[model samples]
Target: MQKHTISAIICLAGALVAAAIAGASFLAMRKPDLIVRGPGVTDVKMLSDWFPGLKGTPGDTEVYILKGADDGASMLVLGGTHPNEPAGHIAAIMLIENAQPKSGTLYVIPRANASGFTANDPQEGAPQSFTIQTPNGPRVFRYGSRATNPIHQWPDPNVYIHASSGQTLSGSETRNLNRGYPGRPDGTLTERVCYGIVQLIKKENVTITVDLHEASPEYPVINAIVAHPKAMQLASDMVLGLEMQDIKISLEPSPVNLRGLTHRELGDFTDTLPVLMETANASQGRLRGRTDEALVLTGKDKWYVRAEKLGRLYVPYDEKGHPLEERVGRHVTAISELMNSWNLEHPEKPLEFEGLPGYEDFLTKGIGVFLLPLPAKN
Candidate 1:
C-alpha cells in the first residue's frame, strides 16, 4: 500500500475508536431506571405541568401528589437538589413509595433536578449507581452531580448574580437549583426548574415547603435544620419534638445575606414558609478517603474518622461511619416531626400521613426493606 493510504487508514481507525467511546459514555448517562410509585401517589405530573416553557426540556421532572379525602393544608418536599447526596433523595423516595396522607396533601419530588441525575461530577470518581435490596429484589438509584448538567445549559458567566436578590456567587452556581429560587421564567435551565417549583407552590397554595439535602461530614451545617424567618417558630417546635425522641437536630436561621438558597430565597419570595434540612455524608466530603458505592452506602471513611478524632469534623465520625440508613432516617423523621409540629400549630389544616418509617425503625431495619420492588420486564 502507498504510505499516504496507510496513514489515512490509521487515522480512520482512531476516529472510529473515539466515536465508540463517546457513544458508550452517552448511554451511561441517558439510561433511565424504573421507580414504581407506591399506594400514596394518587396522581403524577411533571414540573412542566406548572411551567409550560419547561415542557420537552431536560429540566422537566416528575411531581408525585398524594391527596387525602379530608380538607387540610398542603406541603411540598424537594429532594435530590444536589445529586451527590443520596440520603436526601432516597428519603424523599421512601415517602413517595410508602407514606399515605390521610388528612391533607403531600407533594413529593424525589428527583427535583432530573437532569442532574443523568450525569456525575467528572472529577469526583463517584459511582454511577447504588443498590438497596428490597423484599422483591435489589433496586438501584443513580448517584448524580451537585448541579444541573452543563450540557443542558452552558456558557456560565464569570460570576453568577442571582436574579431576585442580586447576590453574586461563583459562575457555576448559576446552574445550582437551590440557588435559583423564585426563579425567572426566562432564566437559565436551572432557574427555570426553580421557577417551575415556585409556580407549583403558588398555584397549589402550599403551606409548607421542605427541601431535603445532605452536606459533607466536615461541613458545619450537617445534622441541622435551616429555616427561613417565617418558618423559625415551626422549625423550633419540631426540633424540640425531635429532641424528645432522642434525635439531636440543630436549628440555623437562614442568613439574609445568603440570598439564593431555598431557605432564604424561597421564604423571601413566596407566601409559603420554607425550611431545609441537612444530613452528613462522607462520600461527598473532602475528607473522604475513597469515593465509591461503599462510601455512598456505608458512609465510613478512615479519613473522616481521623478528622473526627482531631476534632476537625463537624459531626461525630467513627469506624462504624454514618451509614446511609441513619442519614436517610434523620431526614424522614425530621419531616414527620415538621408536619406534626405544623399540625399542632394549625389544627384546622393538619397534614397527616402513615406508613413512613421513623428514625428508630430505619436504624433497626435498614432502608432497603422499605424500598419498593422494581417492575418486572415484559
Candidate 2:
C-alpha cells in the first residue's frame, strides 16, 4: 500500500474515534442528574405545571416544595439560574436535600434553567460534570452553560431588548435566564421559563424570593446581596446578621435601570420581595490560570492569587482559596440569615426552617456527606 493511502486511513480512524468520544460526552451531559428526596421534600412539581407553555420543552424544570408544620408565610429560592455558577447550583441542591420548614413553605428550584445543563459553554473548557463522594458512593453533577442552549433557543439578535422596559443589552443575553424575568407568555423559551417562575410566585403567594448567583472574583458584586427597594430592609438586616456571624456579606439595592433582571422586574411586577446573592468564584473569573475540575472545586488559581496581590479582585483571595464547600457555606448561611430577618419583620406570618447546616457544618463535614444516595429503580 502507498504511504499516503496509509496516512489517509490513519487520519480517518482518528476522526472516527474523536467523533465517538464526543458523542458519548454529549449523551452523558444530556442525562439529567439525580436528586434524592430528603425528609423536607413534601412534593415535587414542574415548571410546566404553573405555565403549560413550557411543557414538552427543555425550559421545564423541577420545583421541590417543603411545607412546614404550621401554615405561615412562604419563600422561594432559585438556584442554577446560571449553570456556570456551580456554587449556587450545589447550594440549591443542598437546600432541597436538607432543609425542613417549621412554619412556612420553602420552595426550591435547583436548575432554574434546565436547558443549560444539557450543554457546556463553547471555548470555556468547563467540565461536563463533577463528582462528590457520599457515604453510599459517588454522586455527580453537571457543570453547564451560562445561558439556555442554542439548540433550544437559537440565533441571537444583534441586541437584546427587554420587553417590559425596552432596555437594550448584548444580543447574547437573550439566552440568559437571569435577564428574562416577569417574562411574557409569547416570548422566547427563556421568557417562558421566567413566566412559569413568576406564575409560581404569584399563585403560591411567596413572601420572599431569593435568587442565588456566583460571580467572578473580579466582578464588583462578589460577596454581596442585591435586593429590590421593597426587599432592601430585609437584605440589610440579613447582611448585619451575616456580619455578626463573620460571613461579612455586603448589601446592594437592585438598580432600577437593570430592567430584565429578577431584582428589578420581579419586585415591580409581583408582591414578593426579590433579592439576589453572589459568591466569588475564581474558576469563572477572566484572570484564572487553568480551567479544570480542580479549579471548579478547589477554586485555587495562581493567577487569581497574583491578581489579589495586585489589588485587582473585589473579594479577598489568598493561598487558602475559596473552595466549593466554602462558597456553598456562604450561600447557605446567608440564606438562613435572610430567613431570620424575614421572621423578625413578619412575626404574624413568620418564615422559619431548620435542618439547614451553616458555614461551620460545611467546614467540618464536606459537601458530599450531606448528599443522599439515589434511589434504586424498581
Candidate 3:
C-alpha cells in the first residue's frame, strides 16, 4: 500500500475507536440510578398521577409517600432540582430510606428533574457518576447536569420569558427546572415538570414545601435558607433551632421579583408555604482545583481555600474542607428543624417524623451509614 494511504487508514481506525467510547458513555448515562425503597415508604406514585400531562414522558418522576396513621398536615421535600448538587438528592434518599412519619405525611421526591440525570453539563469536567462505600459494598449515583437534558428540551430562544411574570433571563435559563415554576400545562418539558410538582402540592394539600439545593462555596447564599414571605416565620424559628444545635445557617426571603422560582411561585400559586435551603459545595465552584468523583465526595479544593483567604467566599473554609457528610447533614438537619417549627406553631395540624439522622450522627457515622444497601439480583 502507498505510504499516505496507510497513514489515512490508521487515522480512520483511531477515529472509530474514539466514537465507540463516546457512544458507550452516552448510553450508560441514560440508565437510571437504583433507589431502593425503605421501611418508611408507605406508597410510591408517579408525578404524572397529579398532572396527567406528564404521563408516558421522561418528565415524570417517582414520589415516595410516608403517611402516618393519624391525620395531620402534609409536607413535600424536593431534591435533585439541579442534579449537579448531589447533597440534595442524597439527603432526600436518606429520608426515604429511614424517615417514618408519626402524625403527618412526608412526601419525598429524590429526583425532581428526571431528565437532568441523563447527561452532564457541557464544558464542565464533572464525572458522570460517583460511588459511595457502603457497609454491603458500593452504591453509585449519577452526577448530572444543572439543567434539564437538551435532548428533552432544545432550541433556546434569545430571551427566555417567565410565563406568569414577564421576567426575562438568559436563553440557557429556559432549560433550568428551578426557573420554570407555576409552569404552564402545555409548556416545554421542564415547564411541564414544574407544573406537575405544583399539581402535587395542591392536590396533596401540602402545608410546607422544601426544595433542597447546593450552591458554589463562593456564592453569597451558601449555608442559607431562602423562604417565601408566608414561610418567613417558620424559617426564622427553624434557623434558631439549627443555631442552637451549633449548625449556623442564614435566612433570606425569596426575592419577590425573582419569577418562576419554587419559593416564589409555589407559595403564590398553592397554599403550600415554600422554602429552599442551600449548602456550600466546593466541587461545583469555579475555583475548584480538580473536577472528579473525589472532589464531589470530599469537597477539599485547595483553590477554594485560597479564595476563602482572599475574602471571596461566603462560608468559612479551611484545610479540613466541607465533606459530603457535612453538606447532607445541614440539609437533613434543616428539614427536621423546619418540621419541628411548623408543628410548634400549628399544633392543631402538627407534622412529626422519626428515623432521620442528625448532624452529629452524619459527622460521626458518615452518609453511607444512612444509605440502604442495594437489592440482590434475581
Candidate 4:
C-alpha cells in the first residue's frame, strides 16, 4: 500500500475503536440501576402516573407508596432533588426498603430527578456510580449531576426566569429540579417532573411534604431544616426531637423572597406543609480534593478539615469526616422525627411509621446493613 493509504487506515481504525468504547459507556450510563422493592412497598407507580405529560420521558421516576393497615393522613418524601447529593437518595431508599407505615401512607420518590442520574456533571471529574457493601454482597448506584442532563434539556438561556414568580437566576438553574417547584404542566422536563410531584400532592392531599437535600459544608444551610411558614411548628418540634437524640440539627424558615423552591412554591400553591432538610456533603463542595467514589461514600477530605480549622465551615468537621452513614442517618432520623412531631401535635390525624434507622444504628452499623443485595441473574 502507498504511505498515505497506510496512514489513512491507521487513523480510521483508531477512530472506530474510540467510537466503540464511547458508545459502550453511553449505553452503560443509560442503563437503569437495579433497585429492589421491599415488603413495605405496596404500589409502585411512575411520576407520569400523576402527570401524564412526563410519560415516555427520562424525567419520569418511580413513586413508592406504602399504605398502613389503617387509614390516616399521607406524607410525601422526596430524595435526589440534586443527583450529586447521594445521602438524600440513599436515605429515601432506606425509607422505602425499611419503613412500614403504621397509621398513614408513606410516599417515597428516591430519584426525584430521574434524568439527572443518566449522566455526571461536566468538568467535575465525578464517578458514574458508587458501591455500598451489603451483608450478601455489594450494591451499586449512580452518581449523577446536580441538574438534569443537558442531553435531556439543552441550550439554557442567558438567564432562567421562574415561571410562577418571575424570579431571575442563572440559566443553568433551569434544569435544577429544586428550582422548579409546583412545576408547570408544559414546561421543561425538570419542570414537568416537579409538576407531577405537585399533582400527586394535590391529588392525594398529602398532609406533609419533606424534601431531602445536601449542601456544601461551608454553606450556611448545612445541617438545617428549612420549612414553609405553615409547617414551622412541626419543623421546630422536629429539631427538638433530633436534639433530644443528640443529632443537633437546626431549623430555618423558608424565605418569602425565594420562589420556585418546595418550601416556598409548594406551600403557596398547595395545602401541603412543605419542608426541606439539608445535610453537609463535602464531596459536592468547592473545597473538595481528589474527587472519587470514596469521597462520595465517605465524605472525607483533608481540604475540608483544613477549611473547618480556618473557621470556614457551617458544620463540624474532623479527621473522622461526615461519612455517608452520618449524613444518611441524620436525614432518615429527621424524617421519622418530623412525623413524630406531627403525631404529637395532631393526635387525631397523625402520621407514623416503623423500621427507619436512627442515628446510632447508622453510626455503628453503616448503611450497608440496610441495603438489600441485588438478586443474581438466572
Candidate 5:
C-alpha cells in the first residue's frame, strides 16, 4: 500500500474505535438511575401528568406522593433543582425512602431537573457518578449539572429576560430551573419543567412548598432559609424550633426583585407558600482544590478550612469539614420543623410525617444506611 493510504487507514480505524466508545458512554447516560420507593410512597406519577407539554420529553420527572390516612393539607418538596447539590438530592431521596406521612400528603420531586442528572457541567471536572455504601452493597448515583443539560435546551440568548416579571439575568441562567418558575408551557426545557412543577402545586393545592438547595461555603446565604413574605411567619417559627434543637439556621426574606426563583415567583403566582433552604457545600465553591467524588462525598478541604480561618466563608469550617451527612441532616431536620410549624399554624390543614432520621441518627449512622441497594435487574 502507498504511505498516504496506510496512514489514512490507521486514522480511520482509530476514529471508528473512538466513536464506538463515545456511543457506549452516551447510551449509559440514557439509562435512568434507580430510586427505591419507600413504604410511604402511595403512588408514583410523572411530571407530565400535571403538565402534558412535558410528556415524552427529557424534562419529565417522577413525582412520589406519600399520602396519609387522615385528611389534611399537602406539602411539596423539591430536590435536585440544582443537580450539583448532593445533599438536596439525597434529602429528597431519604424522605421518599424513610418518611411515613401521617396527616396530609407529602409530594417529593427528588430529581426536579431530571435532564441535568444525565450530564455534568462542562469545565467543572465533576465526577459523573458517586457511590454510597448501602447495607446490601454500594449504590451508585449520578452527580449532574446545576442547569438543564444543554442537549435538551440549546442556544441561550445574550441575556435572558424573565417572562413574568421582565427581570433579566445572564443568558446561561435561562437553563436554571429555579430561575424559570411560573414558567411558560411552550418555553425552554427548563422553563417547561418549572411550569410543570407550578401546575403540580396549584393542582394538588400544596399548602407549603420547600425547595432544597446548596451554595458554595463562601456564599453569604449558606445555612440559610429564604422564605416568601406570606410564608415568613411559618419560616420564623420553624427557625426557632430548629434552633431549639441545636440546629442553627439563618433566615433571609426572598428578594422581591428576584423574578424567577421558587421562593419569589412560586409564592407570587401560585397559592402555595414557598420557602427555599440552602446548605453549605465547599466542593461547589470556586476555591475548591480538586473536584472529585471524594470532595463531593467527604466534603473535607484544606483550602476551605484556611478560607474559614481567614473569615472569608459564611459557615464555620474546621478539619472535620461539612460532610454530606451533616448537610443532609440539616435539610431533613429543617424540613420536619417546617412541617411542624405549618401544622401548628393551620390546624385544619396539617402536614405530618414520621420515620425520618433525626440529627443524631444522621450524624452517627450516616446517609448510606438509608439508601437502598441497587436492584438486581439494574
Candidate 6:
C-alpha cells in the first residue's frame, strides 16, 4: 500500500474507535439509576397522574408516598430540582428509604427533573455518577446536569420569559426547573413538569413544601433556608431548633421579586407554605480544582480551602471540607427540625415521621450506613 493510503486508513480507524466509545457513553447515560422502595414507601405514583400533560414524556418522574395511619397535615419534599446538587437528591433518597410517617403523609420526589438526570452539562468535567459503599455491596447514583437535557428540550431563545409572572431571564435558564415554577400546562417541557408539581400540591392539599438544594461554597446563601412569607414563622422556629442541635443554619425570606422560584411561586399560588434549604457544595463551585467522583463525594478541594482563608467564601471551610455526609446531614436535619417545629405549632395538624438518621449519626456512620439494602431478585 502507498504511504499516504496507509496513514489515511489508520486515521479513519482511530476516528471510528473514538466514535464507538462515545456512543457507548451516551447509551450508558440514558439508563436510569435504580431506586429501591423502602419500608416507608406506601405507594409509588407518576407525576403525570396529577397532570396528564406529562404522561409518556421525558419530564415525568416518580413520586414516593409514605402515608401515616392517622390523619393530619401533609408535606411535599422535592430533591434533585437541580440534579448537579447531589446532597439534595441524596437526602430525598435517604428519606424515601428510611422515614416512616406516623401522623401525616410525606411525598418525596427524589428526581424532580427526570430529564436532567439523563445527561451531564457540557464542558463541566463532571463525573457521570458516584457510588456509595453499602453493607450489601455498592450502589451507584447518577451525577447529572443542572438543567433539562438539551436532547429533551433544545434550542434556547435569546430571552426566556416566565409564564405567570412575565419575568424574564437568560435563555439558558428556560430549562432550569427552579425557574419554571407555577408552570404552564401548555408550555415547554420544563414548564410542564413544574405545572405537574403545582397540580400535585393543589390536588393533595399539601400543607407544607420543602425544596432541597445546594450552592457553591462561595455563594452567600450557602447553609441557609429561604422561606416564603407564609412559611417565615415556621422556618424561624426550625432554624432555632437546628441551632439548638448545633447545626448552625441561617434563615432568609424568599424574595417576592424572584418570580419563578419555588419559595415564591408555590407560596403565592397554592395554600402550601414553601421553604427551600441550601448546603455548601465545593464540587459545584468555580474554585474547585478537579471535578470528579471524589470531589463530589468528599468535597475536599484545596482551592476552596484557600478561598475560605481569603474570606471569599460564605461557609466555613478547612482541610476537612464539607463532605457529602455533612451536606446531606444538614439537609436531613433541617427537614427533621422543620417537621418538629410544624408539629409543635400545629398540634392538631402534626407532621410526624421516624427512622431518619440525625446529623451526628450521618457524620459518624457515613451516608452509606443509612442506605437500605437492595431487594432480592425474583
Question: Which residue pairs come into collision in candidate 1?
Answer: none
Can you write out model 1's per-residue Cα lDDT over 1-378, one digit (the tens) per residue? 999999999999999999999778766876655677999889999999999989999989999999988889999999999988998899889999899989899999888888898888878889888988777888988998899888888988999998877889999999898888888999999999999999999999999999999999889898999999899999999999999999889999998888778898878778889999999988888878889899999998899889998999888889999999999999999999999999999998889999999899999999988988777789
Stretches of candidate 3 exceeding 4 Å from the true structure: 1-13
Q: Over 4 Å off in model 6, which ranges?
A: 1-13
Q: What is the lDDT of candidate 3?
A: 0.93
| Deviation from native of the Cα of residue 26 in model 1, angstroms | 3.6
Cα deviation at 210, candidate 2, in Å, is 0.6
Compose the digit string of candidate 4's lDDT tens values, residues 109-188.
99999989988888898999999999989888898899998999999988999898899999999999999987899999
Positional deviation of 166 in candidate 1, in angstroms? 1.8
Minimum summed lDDT over a 10-residue window in model 3 is located at: 281-290
Number of residue pairs clashing in candidate 3, backbone atoms closer than 3 angstroms, sequence gap of 3 or more or interchain: 0
What TM-score would you give candidate 4 relative to the actual structure? 0.97
Off by over 4 Å in 2: 1-17
Across 289-312, the per-residue lDDT of candidate 5 in tens digits comes to 888888888888999999989999
| Clashing residue pairs in candidate 3 (N, C-alpha, C atoms within 3 angstroms) | none
Candidate 5 wrongly placed segments (more than 4 Å): none
- Against the reference, the lDDT scores of all candidates come to 0.90, 0.91, 0.93, 0.91, 0.91, 0.94
Report the Cα lDDT for residue 13, model 1: 99
Candidate 1 stretches greater than 4 Å from native: 1-15
TM accuracy, model 1: 0.96
Better of 3 and 5 by lDDT: 3
TM-score of 5: 0.97
Model 2, position 281, has a per-residue lDDT of 87
- Write down the TM-score of every candidate: 0.96, 0.96, 0.97, 0.97, 0.97, 0.97
The C-alpha stretches of model 4 lying farther than 4 A from their native spots are 1-9
Clashes of 6: 0
